[model samples]
Target chain A: MDNEVLNTEPQPTEEVRVVMPLVDILDGDDGVTIYFEVPGANSKTVDIEVKNRIMTISAASSLRRDGLPVVFKRNFRLSDGADIENITAKTQDGVLTLNIPKSERAKVHKIQVQ
Target chain B: MNMLARIRNAEELLPSTLGGLHELFRSMLDQVTDLGPEWLPEGSAAGRALTVETSEKEVTVKLPLPGCESKNIDVEVIGDQLTIHAARTEVKDENDKRHYIRRERSFMDYQESVLLPVKVRGHEAKASYVDGILTVTLPRENPGSPDSHVVKVD
Candidate 1:
């Protein structure tokens, strides 16, 4: 394929009808920043977890769609360089910004001239 | 063997784009997707989602404008049409220019008009923006009629 798909879909489970919130990922020298659009989600209802090198984001919103409860859920596989322990996240204006620091090995190293 | 005309043996798997065929495909795809009708394609431009609810006395419309300032949003109700226009701006300093590797939440501007389900008193519309949801409620011009009435057969 000429264009590779960086995004992914959720696993089919009991909650197959979940609302998969869209996301955008940015790579920086120090870390990776991910923004998720989850309207009506607050800090208390949003949950972020990492297990087995997989990051799972799940949130419940007071907003209802089609008279049913709205649940935002998605998963992303983390690279080895992701410093999961030092990850941080913040929710503002219905958007969740997650920052995962890059490990020492993942940082770019320049060779010095002798 | 000489043939006057060429023939193919495969069935028409996909419908043609002419006429209503394309609309049929779009409706089918819309049904498969669980998202609301107001929501546009993912990661695209400033497409927004708005929900409309109507009752016997009034009609309410709600739009989720995340990360947007209330001052930037304008709601107008004219006749039986409701129009909303808003913008989500990016804060940038002239001295510091931050480069983004991937940006899905860039500065966006949106404007859309929707027809109200019932005649509304546009002048009596009340709008409030809170928690990124802009809600507008308008009193019905004629509240005497209910949405539906159960009639008994003799």
Candidate 2:
């Protein structure tokens, strides 16, 4: 029995970490809607800026006991034909929402035949 | 003949009380080995309260930052990845004679990182903070596929 048990040694268990992104997007006729899930994050701890057709969002979280340090980061750029001025955003219920209106030229239009 | 006699004698002289003890030991070992880490929550630590999700058309990043000012939070995107970083200091009132039994929330600086699925045009991204959440919108670049061509047959 001892020899048989020794031959059937149990395998070591693996440690797995779950890393989930905090964002969602919905496309619409006029613009696109983007959603982000940020719990305990306030407006003061976040920065939103648009420069040279680039939009940047960054924030630092408050540290707690036995908590890992915050290293959250993300970046994105706009398309050439995108309309940046009509963009709007809001945050509520630990979720961020942004509306990006399409440019006039980018909107689809039907032509009437004479 | 002497070895066979000793083996038979030991078999007949086994302790009767060890049966229950052996069963208990087996149960304990089974319970300990069956315990898994899945019982714990994901990202269940202080100072790290953010989840990021991305798609081909846009990238959304969320952060849970309570008692933080919206004006202090900053969101930026470099290349194809998005970065969210913010900092704030909490000032406790010394006059208040409030006793705390337990505290789990964090009160220090924190930073989080999110990798976008598609390449985003940084110049056109937008962000907003309404209640306590921060949402960022990044428009994807066009694949620039060629227009369909017409064919004529003779």
Task: Please write out the lDDT profile of model 2 over residues B1-154, one tens digit for every residue.
Answer: 1111222233345466765654443322211011112222344442244555556566666665543567777787889877777665432346534222112334447677777766678899998764455678877774332224579897
lDDT of 1 by residue, B67-101 (tens): 77789999988899999998976533355343344
Q: How does model 1 fare in lDDT?
A: 0.64
Off by over 4 Å in 1: A1-8, A11-17, B1-48, B91-107, B147-154
Q: A1-114 in candidate 2: lDDT tens per residue?
A: 223322222222232222222444444456545554445444555555666554555443432223343422233344433578877776553445556676776555779999
What is candidate 2's fraction of native contacts?
Answer: 0.17
Name every residue pair that clashes in candidate 1: none
iRMS of each prediction: 11.1, 20.6
DockQ of each: 0.15, 0.07
